[model samples]
Target: MSAGRAQAFWLRNLTAKIAAIPMILTSLVIFIGCSIWTVVYSFTSSRSLPVTDFVGFRQYERLFGAHRWSLAVENIAIYGVLTLVFALTVGFILAALLDQKIRFESIFRTIFLYPYAMSFIVTGVVWQWMFNPGLGIQHFVRQLGFENFTFDLISNRNTVIYAIAIAGIWQITGFAMVLMLAGLRAVDDQIWKASRVDGIPAWKTYVMIIIPMMRGVFVTSLVIIAAGIVKLYDLVVAMTNGGPGFASDVPAMYVYNWLFERANLGHAMAASTMMLLTVLIIMVPWFYMEYGRKNKN
Candidate 1:
């Protein structure tokens, strides 16, 4: 082709790239604008409207007014800690068992991991039925002459959160097992042989040696689990809908109500932002300590 034609083609391509720049910039601007708008809205006295004037920190003060915020916070703490502990424990155990040349390792791994693939909405519905006193284990057991059998935690106000935790652990631990198993498989086989030759009990080897070596995996799993907890929503909505009163109310639900039902967009932003901040607070230090400090050396 002639140089003039080639030059014209190059000029057209450059022009197109320049024209596309504004679209990218516009998208970024919109995101930033919304985020700033949300924070600004949270401070206004406007309810059910796009409040422009600022009302200082009154929205934040009101957020702490009733028992709802504190109760939701308490529930989050309880649920988060319990789910983390139980899921990690169960996942580790299952992964370890499967790693030991189990007879049906493939089948067992699939069985353990299948629950992770299902959405929490379905899992929640199934668990709700299982926890039902009338149609579930409680009823079946009572019919077997154990009339005292009672697994009605889902119906009870005080114990409902634990019931939710049961489902959380069930769905999450399988995925955790997959992560842990991958980490476990990455371990050098030489370590296992050496431990065996040195007469280290299998359980002790896991506790003392294997676990320490798997710190990276555990931390990775914990970060992922913590993120899930901070953003927890679907299971609660599907299972109990934060029912039997406000017993199982979470920050996510609270934000949703404020945004839609209560029409308090500003307060919704504050509530939702807190969720983000909470995750950041928990993670930032750990990330710095684990990764940043290591890089410094």
Candidate 2:
């Protein structure tokens, strides 16, 4: 296109463009600018505040060597893996069930999605009480005459990570269900009719035909869930506070404590940079495959 035509096209949407300026500037300054600043300061030897005393990976070396950081990495890995698997599986199953044109489907969707409307902090607080031995499930079970029953996963260091995973799953699974349900509803009606005419079992058709057709939805849901797993912090704070001797600490919590509680600027930046790198590692390939391939085609 010529410059005149390009200018005309741009001017056609001038009002919309003007409306978007604030959001565009905010992304450029706050997101991209702060990210670059964080990466640059990660190499410094700053203690309480940012400084230019270059240390060249010294902070990262200390971050890796710290047992607390190592434990945090392990806890996050466990929590991420468990939450990713259960949330996707359970959410998809719920979506499939709801797609059957069941009774009061709208009410069921609302019931399932209500928890997701609540903030993570609220969900965490509610689950914390639900996990409490004296006040929650265990107490209720004991009241039913099962006095020897034990459901104190939150207090046990070894099982606290699982409790956090369960809470995270409960909060996000409904959102995943909504995504999957949209995908399911988008399936061509003729395809189902064809399957019925061919006498194909519904389960077999779903597994062998319908699932393969929803690749875009599955990929979108996968990325969203994985991103959540990477930056997990709020739920851990409200639920466990990295307690029971730091057994449930995650990378985000580690970075926060180092930055504020320990006053270690460089170290905290290094951890945060590492997190940013992990997210990039996961996202770059997906972006390449999803958008780059489309552009190429």
TM-score, every prediction: 0.87, 0.92
RMSD of each: 4.7, 3.1
The 0-to-1 C-alpha lDDT of every candidate, in the order given, reads: 0.88, 0.92
lDDT of 1 at 269: 77
> For residues 198-237, what per-residue lDDT tens digits would candidate 1 score against the true structure?
9999999999999999998998899899899988889999
Q: Which candidate has the top score in TM-score?
A: 2
The runs of at least 3 residues in candidate 2 whose Cα sits more than 4 Å from the true structure, single-residue gaps closed, are 1-21
Error of 2 at 242 (Å): 0.7
Q: Residue-pair clashes per candidate, as listed?
A: 0, 0
Candidate 2 on 1-297: residue-level lDDT in tens? 699998999899899999999999889998999999999999999989889999898989998999999999899889988888888889999999999989999999999989889988998999999999998999999999999999999999999999999999998899899999999999999999999999999999999999999888888898999998988999989999998989889999999998999998899999999899989988998998899879998
Q: Which pairs clash in the backbone of model 2?
A: none
